[model samples]
Target: MSQGVSPAAARGLKYRALRALFRHFGRMRPAARLRLGRWLGALAYRCVRPRVKVARRNLELCFPQMSEARREALLREHFHALAQSVVDRGVLWYAPPEKVREMVALSGYEHLQRQLDAGQSCILLAPHFIGLDAAASRLTMQCPSGATMYAPQSDPAVDAIVREGRTRFNDVHLVSRRDGVRSLLRHIRAARPIYYLPDMDLGRKGAVFVPFFGVPAATMPSTAQIARTWQLPVLPVLSHWDAATGRYHIEVLPPLEDFPGEQDAEAATARLNALLEQWVLRMPAQYYWVHRRFKTRPAGQPKLY
Candidate 1:
Protein backbone atom coordinates (compact mmCIF):
# COMPACT_ATOMS: atom_id res chain seq x y z
CA MET A 1 0.00 0.00 0.00
CA SER A 2 1.29 3.44 -0.90
CA GLN A 3 1.12 6.15 1.71
CA GLY A 4 -0.70 9.41 0.85
CA VAL A 5 1.75 12.27 0.14
CA SER A 6 1.17 15.66 1.75
CA PRO A 7 1.35 18.90 -0.32
CA ALA A 8 4.87 19.64 0.97
CA ALA A 9 5.91 16.07 0.27
CA ALA A 10 4.53 16.33 -3.26
CA ARG A 11 6.45 19.55 -3.89
CA GLY A 12 9.63 17.94 -2.60
CA LEU A 13 9.01 14.98 -4.86
CA LYS A 14 8.76 17.30 -7.89
CA TYR A 15 12.00 19.04 -6.93
CA ARG A 16 13.81 15.75 -6.43
CA ALA A 17 12.47 14.50 -9.73
CA LEU A 18 13.98 17.48 -11.58
CA ARG A 19 17.28 17.12 -9.75
CA ALA A 20 17.46 13.42 -10.45
CA LEU A 21 16.76 14.02 -14.12
CA PHE A 22 19.83 16.27 -14.36
CA ARG A 23 21.94 13.95 -12.27
CA HIS A 24 21.02 11.04 -14.50
CA PHE A 25 21.94 13.10 -17.55
CA GLY A 26 25.25 14.18 -16.01
CA ARG A 27 26.09 10.79 -14.53
CA MET A 28 25.05 8.34 -17.20
CA ARG A 29 28.30 6.59 -18.11
CA PRO A 30 31.18 5.69 -15.78
CA ALA A 31 33.26 8.62 -17.05
CA ALA A 32 30.24 10.89 -17.52
CA ARG A 33 30.87 12.77 -14.28
CA LEU A 34 34.39 13.78 -15.31
CA ARG A 35 33.34 14.69 -18.82
CA LEU A 36 30.32 16.66 -17.66
CA GLY A 37 32.47 18.48 -15.10
CA ARG A 38 34.93 19.70 -17.73
CA TRP A 39 32.05 20.72 -19.96
CA LEU A 40 30.30 22.49 -17.08
CA GLY A 41 33.52 24.28 -16.18
CA ALA A 42 33.86 25.63 -19.68
CA LEU A 43 30.17 26.51 -19.92
CA ALA A 44 30.22 28.33 -16.59
CA TYR A 45 33.23 30.35 -17.71
CA ARG A 46 31.38 31.41 -20.86
CA CYS A 47 27.84 32.08 -19.60
CA VAL A 48 28.30 33.31 -16.03
CA ARG A 49 30.58 36.23 -16.77
CA PRO A 50 29.66 38.45 -13.79
CA ARG A 51 31.36 36.23 -11.21
CA VAL A 52 34.59 36.35 -13.18
CA LYS A 53 34.27 40.13 -13.52
CA VAL A 54 33.94 40.51 -9.74
CA ALA A 55 36.97 38.29 -9.25
CA ARG A 56 38.85 40.63 -11.57
CA ARG A 57 37.75 43.60 -9.49
CA ASN A 58 38.95 41.84 -6.35
CA LEU A 59 42.34 41.15 -7.88
CA GLU A 60 42.61 44.73 -9.08
CA LEU A 61 41.73 46.05 -5.63
CA CYS A 62 44.31 43.76 -4.05
CA PHE A 63 46.97 44.37 -6.67
CA PRO A 64 46.55 47.92 -7.91
CA GLN A 65 49.85 48.10 -9.76
CA MET A 66 49.06 45.15 -12.06
CA SER A 67 47.85 46.07 -15.56
CA GLU A 68 44.16 45.58 -16.49
CA ALA A 69 45.03 42.82 -18.95
CA ARG A 70 46.96 40.86 -16.32
CA ARG A 71 44.05 41.12 -13.87
CA GLU A 72 41.68 39.84 -16.57
CA ALA A 73 43.95 36.89 -17.17
CA LEU A 74 43.95 36.10 -13.45
CA LEU A 75 40.18 36.36 -13.41
CA ARG A 76 39.76 33.94 -16.31
CA GLU A 77 42.21 31.49 -14.80
CA HIS A 78 40.53 31.66 -11.40
CA PHE A 79 37.08 30.98 -12.84
CA HIS A 80 38.33 28.01 -14.81
CA ALA A 81 40.14 26.57 -11.78
CA LEU A 82 37.09 27.08 -9.56
CA ALA A 83 34.92 25.37 -12.17
CA GLN A 84 37.35 22.47 -12.32
CA SER A 85 37.16 22.21 -8.56
CA VAL A 86 33.39 22.07 -8.76
CA VAL A 87 33.48 19.41 -11.46
CA ASP A 88 36.18 17.47 -9.60
CA ARG A 89 33.74 16.91 -6.77
CA GLY A 90 32.12 14.30 -8.96
CA VAL A 91 35.44 12.48 -9.22
CA LEU A 92 36.23 12.94 -5.54
CA TRP A 93 32.91 11.39 -4.58
CA TYR A 94 33.03 8.46 -7.00
CA ALA A 95 36.63 7.82 -8.04
CA PRO A 96 38.59 4.88 -6.60
CA PRO A 97 41.30 5.51 -3.99
CA GLU A 98 44.07 4.41 -6.35
CA LYS A 99 42.87 6.79 -9.08
CA VAL A 100 42.57 9.66 -6.62
CA ARG A 101 46.07 8.98 -5.27
CA GLU A 102 47.61 9.55 -8.68
CA MET A 103 46.25 13.12 -8.80
CA VAL A 104 47.93 14.34 -5.61
CA ALA A 105 51.67 14.86 -4.96
CA LEU A 106 52.13 15.10 -1.18
CA SER A 107 55.40 16.50 0.20
CA GLY A 108 55.23 16.62 4.01
CA TYR A 109 54.09 13.52 5.88
CA GLU A 110 56.98 13.43 8.37
CA HIS A 111 55.63 16.25 10.59
CA LEU A 112 52.31 14.45 10.92
CA GLN A 113 54.12 11.17 11.74
CA ARG A 114 56.34 12.84 14.33
CA GLN A 115 53.33 14.30 16.15
CA LEU A 116 51.52 10.97 16.30
CA ASP A 117 54.67 9.15 17.37
CA ALA A 118 54.92 11.47 20.36
CA GLY A 119 51.40 10.34 21.41
CA GLN A 120 50.13 13.85 20.61
CA SER A 121 47.45 15.08 18.22
CA CYS A 122 47.81 17.88 15.66
CA ILE A 123 45.33 20.00 13.71
CA LEU A 124 45.82 20.12 9.92
CA LEU A 125 44.54 23.47 8.55
CA ALA A 126 43.99 23.51 4.81
CA PRO A 127 42.30 26.28 2.88
CA HIS A 128 40.23 25.92 -0.32
CA PHE A 129 42.20 24.20 -3.10
CA ILE A 130 41.55 21.59 -5.81
CA GLY A 131 43.62 18.82 -4.15
CA LEU A 132 42.24 19.48 -0.64
CA ASP A 133 39.50 16.85 -0.79
CA ALA A 134 41.95 14.30 -2.17
CA ALA A 135 44.46 15.06 0.59
CA ALA A 136 41.83 14.64 3.32
CA SER A 137 40.67 11.32 1.90
CA ARG A 138 44.30 10.17 1.53
CA LEU A 139 45.18 11.21 5.08
CA THR A 140 42.32 9.21 6.56
CA MET A 141 43.43 6.12 4.65
CA GLN A 142 46.96 6.48 5.99
CA CYS A 143 45.95 7.57 9.49
CA PRO A 144 42.89 5.66 10.64
CA SER A 145 42.72 7.41 14.00
CA GLY A 146 42.65 10.88 12.44
CA ALA A 147 39.36 12.79 12.69
CA THR A 148 38.00 15.85 10.87
CA MET A 149 35.02 18.17 10.92
CA TYR A 150 32.00 17.76 8.63
CA ALA A 151 29.35 20.38 7.86
CA PRO A 152 25.96 18.70 7.72
CA GLN A 153 24.08 19.22 4.44
CA SER A 154 20.60 20.49 3.86
CA ASP A 155 19.87 17.72 1.39
CA PRO A 156 19.93 14.36 3.12
CA ALA A 157 20.71 12.41 -0.06
CA VAL A 158 23.70 14.58 -1.01
CA ASP A 159 24.90 14.52 2.60
CA ALA A 160 24.89 10.73 2.56
CA ILE A 161 26.89 10.67 -0.66
CA VAL A 162 29.50 13.10 0.75
CA ARG A 163 29.79 11.21 4.04
CA GLU A 164 30.24 7.90 2.27
CA GLY A 165 33.10 9.19 0.12
CA ARG A 166 34.89 11.00 2.98
CA THR A 167 34.70 8.01 5.34
CA ARG A 168 35.55 5.36 2.73
CA PHE A 169 39.27 5.94 3.35
CA ASN A 170 38.90 4.85 6.98
CA ASP A 171 36.45 5.54 9.78
CA VAL A 172 37.57 9.16 10.11
CA HIS A 173 35.43 10.69 12.83
CA LEU A 174 33.40 13.62 11.47
CA VAL A 175 32.68 16.23 14.15
CA SER A 176 29.80 18.64 13.65
CA ARG A 177 30.26 22.37 14.17
CA ARG A 178 27.03 22.39 16.24
CA ASP A 179 28.89 20.59 19.03
CA GLY A 180 30.31 24.01 19.85
CA VAL A 181 33.52 24.07 21.90
CA ARG A 182 33.13 20.71 23.62
CA SER A 183 33.39 18.47 20.54
CA LEU A 184 36.77 19.83 19.31
CA LEU A 185 38.27 20.09 22.80
CA ARG A 186 37.30 16.48 23.55
CA HIS A 187 39.03 15.28 20.38
CA ILE A 188 42.23 17.15 21.23
CA ARG A 189 42.33 15.80 24.79
CA ALA A 190 42.07 12.26 23.49
CA ALA A 191 44.90 12.87 20.98
CA ARG A 192 42.62 11.81 18.13
CA PRO A 193 43.92 14.55 15.77
CA ILE A 194 41.40 16.61 13.78
CA TYR A 195 41.46 18.60 10.53
CA TYR A 196 39.70 21.93 9.93
CA LEU A 197 39.40 24.75 7.38
CA PRO A 198 40.68 27.77 9.30
CA ASP A 199 40.07 30.43 6.64
CA MET A 200 36.72 32.14 5.78
CA ASP A 201 34.33 34.25 7.85
CA LEU A 202 32.62 32.04 10.44
CA GLY A 203 31.33 34.99 12.50
CA ARG A 204 32.56 36.72 15.68
CA LYS A 205 31.86 34.01 18.23
CA GLY A 206 33.96 31.03 17.06
CA ALA A 207 36.20 33.44 15.09
CA VAL A 208 38.40 36.47 15.48
CA PHE A 209 38.64 38.97 12.61
CA VAL A 210 42.23 39.06 11.40
CA PRO A 211 44.22 40.44 8.49
CA PHE A 212 44.08 37.97 5.60
CA PHE A 213 45.52 39.02 2.23
CA GLY A 214 45.93 42.50 3.77
CA VAL A 215 42.19 42.67 4.42
CA PRO A 216 40.14 41.75 7.46
CA ALA A 217 38.85 38.18 7.10
CA ALA A 218 37.22 36.44 10.05
CA THR A 219 39.23 33.38 11.13
CA MET A 220 38.24 30.44 13.33
CA PRO A 221 39.87 30.63 16.78
CA SER A 222 39.24 26.96 17.60
CA THR A 223 42.65 25.92 16.20
CA ALA A 224 44.65 28.30 18.35
CA GLN A 225 42.48 27.73 21.44
CA ILE A 226 42.84 23.98 21.30
CA ALA A 227 46.56 24.21 20.70
CA ARG A 228 47.03 26.52 23.68
CA THR A 229 44.56 24.89 26.08
CA TRP A 230 45.53 21.28 25.39
CA GLN A 231 49.14 22.26 24.62
CA LEU A 232 48.88 20.43 21.26
CA PRO A 233 51.26 21.21 18.45
CA VAL A 234 49.74 23.41 15.73
CA LEU A 235 50.84 22.34 12.26
CA PRO A 236 50.04 24.54 9.26
CA VAL A 237 49.23 22.22 6.38
CA LEU A 238 48.37 23.26 2.81
CA SER A 239 47.99 21.10 -0.32
CA HIS A 240 48.84 22.89 -3.54
CA TRP A 241 48.12 21.37 -6.97
CA ASP A 242 50.79 22.57 -9.39
CA ALA A 243 49.59 22.34 -12.97
CA ALA A 244 53.07 23.10 -14.31
CA THR A 245 54.50 20.09 -12.44
CA GLY A 246 51.26 18.07 -12.75
CA ARG A 247 51.43 17.09 -9.06
CA TYR A 248 50.16 18.03 -5.62
CA HIS A 249 52.53 19.34 -2.92
CA ILE A 250 51.27 18.98 0.62
CA GLU A 251 53.53 21.08 2.88
CA VAL A 252 53.50 20.89 6.67
CA LEU A 253 54.85 24.06 8.22
CA PRO A 254 56.80 23.90 11.48
CA PRO A 255 54.65 23.68 14.60
CA LEU A 256 53.74 27.09 16.00
CA GLU A 257 55.95 26.64 19.06
CA ASP A 258 55.68 30.29 20.12
CA PHE A 259 51.95 30.84 20.06
CA PRO A 260 49.63 32.99 22.23
CA GLY A 261 51.96 32.93 25.25
CA GLU A 262 53.90 36.05 24.38
CA GLN A 263 50.93 37.70 22.63
CA ASP A 264 47.13 37.98 22.93
CA ALA A 265 44.62 35.60 21.33
CA GLU A 266 43.83 37.88 18.39
CA ALA A 267 47.55 38.36 17.68
CA ALA A 268 48.14 34.63 17.56
CA THR A 269 45.15 34.29 15.23
CA ALA A 270 46.64 37.06 13.07
CA ARG A 271 49.91 35.14 12.77
CA LEU A 272 48.09 32.09 11.46
CA ASN A 273 46.08 34.27 9.10
CA ALA A 274 49.29 35.76 7.75
CA LEU A 275 50.64 32.32 7.00
CA LEU A 276 47.42 31.35 5.20
CA GLU A 277 47.59 34.58 3.19
CA GLN A 278 51.09 33.70 1.99
CA TRP A 279 49.89 30.30 0.80
CA VAL A 280 46.88 31.75 -1.05
CA LEU A 281 48.96 34.49 -2.70
CA ARG A 282 51.27 31.78 -4.00
CA MET A 283 48.33 30.36 -5.98
CA PRO A 284 45.68 33.06 -6.16
CA ALA A 285 43.53 31.17 -8.64
CA GLN A 286 43.21 28.17 -6.32
CA TYR A 287 41.74 30.31 -3.53
CA TYR A 288 37.97 30.67 -3.32
CA TRP A 289 36.70 34.09 -4.47
CA VAL A 290 33.01 33.23 -4.35
CA HIS A 291 33.25 33.55 -0.62
CA ARG A 292 32.11 37.01 0.48
CA ARG A 293 35.22 37.12 2.63
CA PHE A 294 34.81 40.80 3.43
CA LYS A 295 31.09 40.54 4.19
CA THR A 296 31.28 40.99 7.92
CA ARG A 297 32.47 44.57 8.19
CA PRO A 298 33.67 46.24 11.38
CA ALA A 299 31.08 47.83 13.71
CA GLY A 300 31.28 51.46 12.49
CA GLN A 301 31.69 50.61 8.80
CA PRO A 302 29.17 49.99 6.01
CA LYS A 303 28.32 46.45 4.95
CA LEU A 304 30.24 45.17 1.92
CA TYR A 305 27.67 42.55 1.07
Candidate 2:
Protein backbone atom coordinates (compact mmCIF):
# COMPACT_ATOMS: atom_id res chain seq x y z
CA MET A 1 0.00 0.00 0.00
CA SER A 2 3.00 2.32 0.26
CA GLN A 3 6.03 3.12 -1.86
CA GLY A 4 9.37 2.38 -0.25
CA VAL A 5 11.77 5.02 1.04
CA SER A 6 11.02 8.58 -0.11
CA PRO A 7 13.96 11.03 -0.24
CA ALA A 8 12.77 12.57 2.99
CA ALA A 9 12.98 9.11 4.52
CA ALA A 10 16.54 8.56 3.30
CA ARG A 11 17.60 11.94 4.57
CA GLY A 12 15.94 11.19 7.88
CA LEU A 13 17.99 8.04 8.23
CA LYS A 14 21.24 9.90 7.66
CA TYR A 15 20.09 12.61 10.02
CA ARG A 16 19.33 10.05 12.73
CA ALA A 17 22.70 8.38 12.41
CA LEU A 18 24.45 11.71 12.73
CA ARG A 19 22.28 12.66 15.70
CA ALA A 20 22.90 9.37 17.49
CA LEU A 21 26.64 9.76 17.01
CA PHE A 22 26.50 13.26 18.39
CA ARG A 23 24.37 12.22 21.35
CA HIS A 24 26.79 9.45 22.17
CA PHE A 25 29.66 11.91 22.44
CA GLY A 26 28.27 15.29 23.49
CA ARG A 27 25.87 14.42 26.31
CA MET A 28 28.26 14.64 29.25
CA ARG A 29 27.41 18.10 30.57
CA PRO A 30 24.07 19.89 30.09
CA ALA A 31 25.65 23.37 29.82
CA ALA A 32 28.35 22.22 27.41
CA ARG A 33 25.79 20.39 25.28
CA LEU A 34 23.70 23.53 24.91
CA ARG A 35 26.79 25.60 24.07
CA LEU A 36 27.71 22.99 21.49
CA GLY A 37 24.14 23.21 20.23
CA ARG A 38 24.57 26.97 19.68
CA TRP A 39 27.70 26.44 17.58
CA LEU A 40 26.16 23.64 15.53
CA GLY A 41 23.02 25.72 15.06
CA ALA A 42 25.16 28.61 13.82
CA LEU A 43 26.74 26.33 11.26
CA ALA A 44 23.34 25.02 10.15
CA TYR A 45 22.07 28.59 9.87
CA ARG A 46 24.90 29.37 7.42
CA CYS A 47 24.29 26.34 5.22
CA VAL A 48 20.57 27.01 5.06
CA ARG A 49 20.86 30.77 4.90
CA PRO A 50 19.23 30.99 1.46
CA ARG A 51 16.28 28.85 2.53
CA VAL A 52 16.07 30.72 5.82
CA LYS A 53 16.13 33.98 3.87
CA VAL A 54 13.17 32.84 1.81
CA ALA A 55 11.31 31.89 4.98
CA ARG A 56 12.14 35.32 6.40
CA ARG A 57 10.67 36.89 3.29
CA ASN A 58 7.50 34.93 3.94
CA LEU A 59 7.42 36.11 7.55
CA GLU A 60 7.84 39.69 6.33
CA LEU A 61 4.90 39.23 4.00
CA CYS A 62 2.79 37.81 6.80
CA PHE A 63 3.77 40.42 9.40
CA PRO A 64 3.71 43.56 7.25
CA GLN A 65 3.81 45.97 10.18
CA MET A 66 7.29 44.85 11.32
CA SER A 67 10.24 46.66 9.74
CA GLU A 68 12.66 44.71 7.53
CA ALA A 69 15.49 45.18 10.04
CA ARG A 70 13.48 43.81 12.93
CA ARG A 71 12.17 40.91 10.84
CA GLU A 72 15.70 39.99 9.78
CA ALA A 73 16.87 40.02 13.39
CA LEU A 74 14.01 37.70 14.31
CA LEU A 75 14.86 35.35 11.46
CA ARG A 76 18.52 35.09 12.48
CA GLU A 77 17.65 34.49 16.11
CA HIS A 78 15.08 31.89 15.06
CA PHE A 79 17.68 29.92 13.10
CA HIS A 80 20.17 30.01 15.96
CA ALA A 81 17.44 28.77 18.25
CA LEU A 82 16.54 26.10 15.69
CA ALA A 83 20.15 24.91 15.66
CA GLN A 84 20.22 24.74 19.44
CA SER A 85 17.11 22.59 19.27
CA VAL A 86 18.99 20.00 17.24
CA VAL A 87 22.01 19.74 19.58
CA ASP A 88 19.90 19.50 22.72
CA ARG A 89 18.51 16.16 21.57
CA GLY A 90 21.66 14.54 22.94
CA VAL A 91 20.90 15.81 26.40
CA LEU A 92 17.23 14.97 26.10
CA TRP A 93 17.70 11.34 25.06
CA TYR A 94 20.90 10.28 26.76
CA ALA A 95 21.11 12.20 30.01
CA PRO A 96 19.85 10.54 33.19
CA PRO A 97 16.21 11.12 34.13
CA GLU A 98 17.03 13.21 37.20
CA LYS A 99 19.38 15.44 35.18
CA VAL A 100 16.80 15.79 32.41
CA ARG A 101 14.17 16.65 35.01
CA GLU A 102 16.54 19.21 36.49
CA MET A 103 16.95 20.91 33.10
CA VAL A 104 13.15 21.17 32.72
CA ALA A 105 11.04 22.86 35.39
CA LEU A 106 7.29 22.36 35.50
CA SER A 107 5.51 25.56 36.46
CA GLY A 108 1.85 24.66 35.97
CA TYR A 109 1.45 21.11 37.22
CA GLU A 110 -1.19 22.14 39.71
CA HIS A 111 -3.27 23.52 36.89
CA LEU A 112 -2.95 20.33 34.84
CA GLN A 113 -3.70 18.23 37.91
CA ARG A 114 -6.74 20.32 38.74
CA GLN A 115 -8.05 19.79 35.23
CA LEU A 116 -7.52 16.05 35.62
CA ASP A 117 -9.21 16.13 38.97
CA ALA A 118 -12.32 17.48 37.27
CA GLY A 119 -12.75 14.05 35.59
CA GLN A 120 -12.11 15.46 32.12
CA SER A 121 -9.28 14.15 29.97
CA CYS A 122 -7.11 17.01 28.69
CA ILE A 123 -5.85 17.45 25.16
CA LEU A 124 -2.51 19.23 25.63
CA LEU A 125 -2.05 21.31 22.46
CA ALA A 126 1.67 22.05 22.68
CA PRO A 127 3.45 24.02 20.01
CA HIS A 128 6.81 23.10 18.49
CA PHE A 129 9.01 25.00 20.91
CA ILE A 130 12.69 24.63 21.81
CA GLY A 131 13.49 21.35 23.53
CA LEU A 132 9.93 20.26 22.96
CA ASP A 133 10.61 16.56 23.13
CA ALA A 134 12.62 17.03 26.32
CA ALA A 135 9.69 18.79 27.87
CA ALA A 136 7.36 16.07 26.63
CA SER A 137 9.63 13.42 28.05
CA ARG A 138 9.81 15.22 31.38
CA LEU A 139 6.07 15.64 31.50
CA THR A 140 5.64 11.92 30.88
CA MET A 141 7.81 11.23 33.90
CA GLN A 142 5.07 12.89 35.90
CA CYS A 143 2.10 11.66 33.88
CA PRO A 144 3.15 8.20 32.73
CA SER A 145 0.07 7.00 30.88
CA GLY A 146 -0.34 9.97 28.57
CA ALA A 147 0.07 9.65 24.78
CA THR A 148 1.48 11.90 22.05
CA MET A 149 1.51 11.87 18.27
CA TYR A 150 4.51 12.26 15.95
CA ALA A 151 5.03 12.12 12.20
CA PRO A 152 7.04 9.06 11.37
CA GLN A 153 10.53 9.68 10.02
CA SER A 154 11.28 8.38 6.54
CA ASP A 155 14.33 6.57 7.79
CA PRO A 156 13.86 3.57 10.04
CA ALA A 157 17.06 4.44 11.86
CA VAL A 158 15.77 7.89 12.59
CA ASP A 159 12.35 6.61 13.61
CA ALA A 160 13.99 4.28 16.09
CA ILE A 161 16.06 7.13 17.53
CA VAL A 162 13.08 9.44 17.79
CA ARG A 163 11.02 6.75 19.47
CA GLU A 164 13.82 6.21 21.98
CA GLY A 165 14.05 9.90 22.66
CA ARG A 166 10.30 10.26 23.02
CA THR A 167 9.30 7.10 24.88
CA ARG A 168 11.77 7.16 27.73
CA PHE A 169 8.99 6.68 30.24
CA ASN A 170 7.54 3.20 30.56
CA ASP A 171 3.87 3.75 29.73
CA VAL A 172 4.05 6.62 27.24
CA HIS A 173 2.90 6.01 23.65
CA LEU A 174 3.67 7.52 20.23
CA VAL A 175 0.88 7.42 17.68
CA SER A 176 1.75 8.21 14.05
CA ARG A 177 -0.64 10.56 12.25
CA ARG A 178 -1.77 7.92 9.76
CA ASP A 179 -3.20 5.78 12.60
CA GLY A 180 -3.79 8.64 15.05
CA VAL A 181 -7.44 9.52 14.54
CA ARG A 182 -8.87 6.23 15.68
CA SER A 183 -6.24 5.92 18.40
CA LEU A 184 -7.00 9.41 19.70
CA LEU A 185 -10.71 8.67 19.92
CA ARG A 186 -10.04 5.50 21.84
CA HIS A 187 -7.72 7.31 24.20
CA ILE A 188 -10.29 10.02 24.77
CA ARG A 189 -13.00 7.47 25.51
CA ALA A 190 -10.71 5.88 28.03
CA ALA A 191 -10.03 9.27 29.64
CA ARG A 192 -6.33 9.10 28.76
CA PRO A 193 -4.66 12.46 28.23
CA ILE A 194 -3.07 12.96 24.81
CA TYR A 195 -0.80 15.59 23.24
CA TYR A 196 -0.73 16.85 19.65
CA LEU A 197 0.75 19.80 17.74
CA PRO A 198 -2.05 21.07 15.48
CA ASP A 199 -0.20 24.14 14.18
CA MET A 200 1.11 22.74 10.87
CA ASP A 201 -0.95 22.33 7.71
CA LEU A 202 -2.05 18.69 7.56
CA GLY A 203 -2.84 18.74 3.83
CA ARG A 204 -6.30 19.82 2.52
CA LYS A 205 -8.57 16.87 3.19
CA GLY A 206 -11.10 17.06 6.05
CA ALA A 207 -9.75 20.44 7.22
CA VAL A 208 -11.50 23.71 8.03
CA PHE A 209 -9.94 27.00 6.96
CA VAL A 210 -9.71 29.52 9.80
CA PRO A 211 -8.05 32.89 10.40
CA PHE A 212 -4.56 32.71 11.88
CA PHE A 213 -2.87 36.08 12.40
CA GLY A 214 -5.30 37.72 9.92
CA VAL A 215 -4.70 35.04 7.28
CA PRO A 216 -7.07 32.20 6.46
CA ALA A 217 -5.17 28.97 6.95
CA ALA A 218 -6.30 25.34 6.78
CA THR A 219 -6.53 23.83 10.27
CA MET A 220 -7.19 20.24 11.22
CA PRO A 221 -10.80 20.17 12.35
CA SER A 222 -10.37 16.81 14.00
CA THR A 223 -9.07 18.28 17.27
CA ALA A 224 -11.95 20.66 17.68
CA GLN A 225 -14.42 18.08 16.54
CA ILE A 226 -13.19 15.64 19.14
CA ALA A 227 -13.33 18.31 21.83
CA ARG A 228 -16.88 19.27 20.90
CA THR A 229 -18.09 15.69 20.64
CA TRP A 230 -16.46 14.44 23.80
CA GLN A 231 -16.65 17.70 25.75
CA LEU A 232 -12.94 17.36 26.53
CA PRO A 233 -11.26 20.47 27.85
CA VAL A 234 -8.50 21.72 25.50
CA LEU A 235 -5.48 23.21 27.23
CA PRO A 236 -2.68 25.24 25.69
CA VAL A 237 0.80 24.20 26.79
CA LEU A 238 4.13 25.81 25.96
CA SER A 239 7.67 24.67 26.77
CA HIS A 240 10.33 27.28 26.18
CA TRP A 241 14.02 27.70 26.89
CA ASP A 242 14.35 30.34 29.59
CA ALA A 243 17.60 32.20 28.98
CA ALA A 244 17.45 33.72 32.46
CA THR A 245 16.77 30.43 34.27
CA GLY A 246 18.98 28.45 31.88
CA ARG A 247 16.35 25.69 31.81
CA TYR A 248 13.13 24.83 30.05
CA HIS A 249 9.85 26.08 31.57
CA ILE A 250 6.58 24.31 30.88
CA GLU A 251 3.54 26.62 31.00
CA VAL A 252 0.16 24.94 31.32
CA LEU A 253 -2.49 27.49 30.53
CA PRO A 254 -6.06 27.51 31.78
CA PRO A 255 -8.51 25.12 30.17
CA LEU A 256 -10.85 26.26 27.41
CA GLU A 257 -14.06 25.34 29.20
CA ASP A 258 -16.09 28.25 27.90
CA PHE A 259 -15.55 28.05 24.15
CA PRO A 260 -19.24 29.07 23.87
CA GLY A 261 -21.16 27.06 21.25
CA GLU A 262 -20.35 23.40 20.96
CA GLN A 263 -21.79 23.20 17.43
CA ASP A 264 -20.37 26.40 15.90
CA ALA A 265 -17.20 24.92 14.42
CA GLU A 266 -15.74 27.98 12.73
CA ALA A 267 -16.03 30.29 15.74
CA ALA A 268 -14.59 27.63 18.06
CA THR A 269 -11.62 27.05 15.75
CA ALA A 270 -11.01 30.80 15.53
CA ARG A 271 -10.91 31.00 19.30
CA LEU A 272 -8.42 28.13 19.47
CA ASN A 273 -6.19 29.79 16.89
CA ALA A 274 -6.32 33.03 18.87
CA LEU A 275 -5.31 31.15 22.00
CA LEU A 276 -2.45 29.57 20.03
CA GLU A 277 -1.39 33.03 18.89
CA GLN A 278 -1.11 34.19 22.48
CA TRP A 279 1.40 31.42 23.19
CA VAL A 280 3.21 31.86 19.88
CA LEU A 281 3.66 35.57 20.43
CA ARG A 282 5.28 34.99 23.80
CA MET A 283 8.27 33.40 22.01
CA PRO A 284 7.93 34.24 18.33
CA ALA A 285 11.57 33.34 17.84
CA GLN A 286 10.92 29.73 18.88
CA TYR A 287 7.75 29.24 16.85
CA TYR A 288 8.13 27.39 13.55
CA TRP A 289 7.81 30.42 11.27
CA VAL A 290 9.38 28.74 8.26
CA HIS A 291 6.30 26.56 7.91
CA ARG A 292 4.00 27.80 5.13
CA ARG A 293 1.09 28.57 7.42
CA PHE A 294 -0.71 30.23 4.56
CA LYS A 295 -0.15 27.29 2.22
CA THR A 296 -3.72 26.09 2.12
CA ARG A 297 -5.14 29.58 1.65
CA PRO A 298 -8.83 30.38 1.63
CA ALA A 299 -10.91 30.17 -1.56
CA GLY A 300 -9.46 32.11 -4.56
CA GLN A 301 -5.94 32.61 -3.22
CA PRO A 302 -2.73 31.20 -4.71
CA LYS A 303 -0.59 28.80 -2.68
CA LEU A 304 2.17 30.71 -0.85
CA TYR A 305 4.54 27.72 -0.77
Q: Which stretches of candidate 1 lie over 4 Å from their true place?
A: 1-38, 48-57, 244-246
Candidate 2 local lDDT, 1-305, one digit each (tens):
01233456446757557656757634556666667666776776678766686668667766789888888777877777777666666666667777777877787777778766765677887876765775687777787467777798885767766776677665676778888576777676666688878777886887788877777878886667777778777777788886544577787777767753554776777777887777778887787776666667667787665
Q: Write the per-residue lDDT of candidate 1 for residues 1-305, one digit (tens) a residue.
A: 11123345345654456445444542444345445545666687688877655566567656678788887777666666666555554444455555556655566678888888887888787777656776776677677576777787786555555565567665577777777656776667677767877766767665677877676766777767776777777777777755443345667666767765667678888988777767878887777775667767666867654
List per-prediction Cα lDDT, in the order shown: 0.66, 0.71
RMSD of each: 5.4, 4.4
Identify the runs in model 2 with alpha carbons over 4 angstroms from their true place: 1-22, 49-51, 115-119
The alpha-carbon deviation from the true structure for residue 5 of candidate 2, after best TM-score superposition, in angstroms, is 18
Clash pairs for candidate 2: 9-154
Q: Please, what is the TM-score per model? A: 0.82, 0.88
